[model samples]
Target: MPDGAPADTVTQLRRDLAAAYRLIAHFGMDDGIYTHISARLPDGPGGEKRFLLNPYGLRFDEVTAANLVTVDETGAVVDDPYGAGVNAAGFTIHSAVHMARHDAVCVLHTHTVAGVAVSSIKEGLLPLNQWSAQFFNRIAFHDYEGIALNLEERERIVADLGEKQVMLLRNHGTLLLGRSVAEAVKLALNLERSCKAQVAALGMGQTPIVLPDDVAEHTAGQYQKMYDKMEGAGGKDPEWDAFLRMLETAAPGYKG
Candidate 1:
């Protein structure tokens, strides 16, 4: 079930998770099916916490509801109809947040060009524009320790992320945590756009004026309020709904 709720929850989760994959692919965020977006399965086998993950070897655009598999906390497959199994390295980051932050229902990671470019920069994301201002004091940075494959790295990531909603995997990519798939998806989109804008602005060979601390903090606070309102109101996102409709035309059959 989506977020591991129960019964129909699985069906809805399957559809929404699949839709998320298609949407990521639609936005050119997916990197040859390498990155992952995981959701906690509340009704996992043995009453233990489990998660829904995309089976390895499948492109994001090829992900369908029926192809998603269930995995335990250790990246072991709890259930697999296709026998495609799981991605140990990819799950390392997701499992860390899932285990440490119970409030995070969805963990989305991406290896987009802009995301990786920004991650490699030392200054990280500058509060240059309104989009960038939204992340002021709301993002974390974790030093990359090579490819994430060990449990210790997971613990470090969790520690660095703390309570922030977004994180930049230094010299790597980006990580987003959300209480719902819609929230996570929206955050990822905004972060990507922010990075993309930063990179474009830098190309102009002129340092963009940074927002003052007071203005940046106030703008970020306003955005946080809107997010709180969305989360409180059942996490409904009109953008997600519009994306699903677009998926039906651009990449149909994700719901299957």
Candidate 2:
């Protein structure tokens, strides 16, 4: 085998991860050159651990299958053909979840306006809407400790996010983890929608209607069951195909 990933696996992972970046940009979830989404790479021929991430300094919309960089678990660029650098400073959070959560094959972090706004609120995300209800009693929160640059922060982050699908960084943004890129993207979209709806509701001055505990728990369970079904045999993800088509039309050659 070559020094890098097997061509077929690399090809599929690249397309899947690049599509996620484009979808994030398309839906206005990107924060310019900030934020990151990473996919775990199988151990290399030499038993080196690595992951795929966007090249540092590129806008999410500019990412393509070929431009994504491969980096070691420590955030060091390993075999990126373009010689692009890694975002070690920002990757602290990503590496933490990827290493701690074995099921987190794909990790996405975003700094969208709505997410940040909701994070600053004392109550965090509320079950004020169907979208928010899905996260009821299931989300985690981590206090903002300045920027996530230090490696020591990794332990704290992993401890805070234990077994949760989504995490809200206090006074910061949101983080989502999934077994695949498609699942993470879908969760990201829902979380952003939840935050946006909460922001809108809070501005109205009138008290927002919160679902009863039983109803919220029931709705959350239903949402989880739906996700499980989508991951089953003969089932399909609802957002992956739609976003792929969007990229095909607007960002042609994204898979290249």
Error of 2 at 69 (Å): 0.4
- List all candidate RMSDs to the true structure: 1.7, 2.3
Give the range where candidate 2 is weakest over 10 consecutive residues by summed lDDT. Answer: 1-10
lDDT of 2 by residue, 8-109 (tens): 976887899999999999999998899999998887778876788988889999898898998888888887765668778888999888878877879999
Task: Give lDDT tens digits, candidate 1, residues 14-133.
Answer: 888888898899899999969999988775446677888999999999888899989888888988866889787789999899989988888999999999999999999988889989
- For candidate 1, give the lDDT of residue 129: 89
- How far residue 224's Cα lies from its native spot in candidate 1, in Å, is 1.2
The pairs that clash in candidate 2 are none
| Cα distance off (Å), candidate 1, residue 199 | 0.5
TM for every model, in the order presented, reads 0.95, 0.95
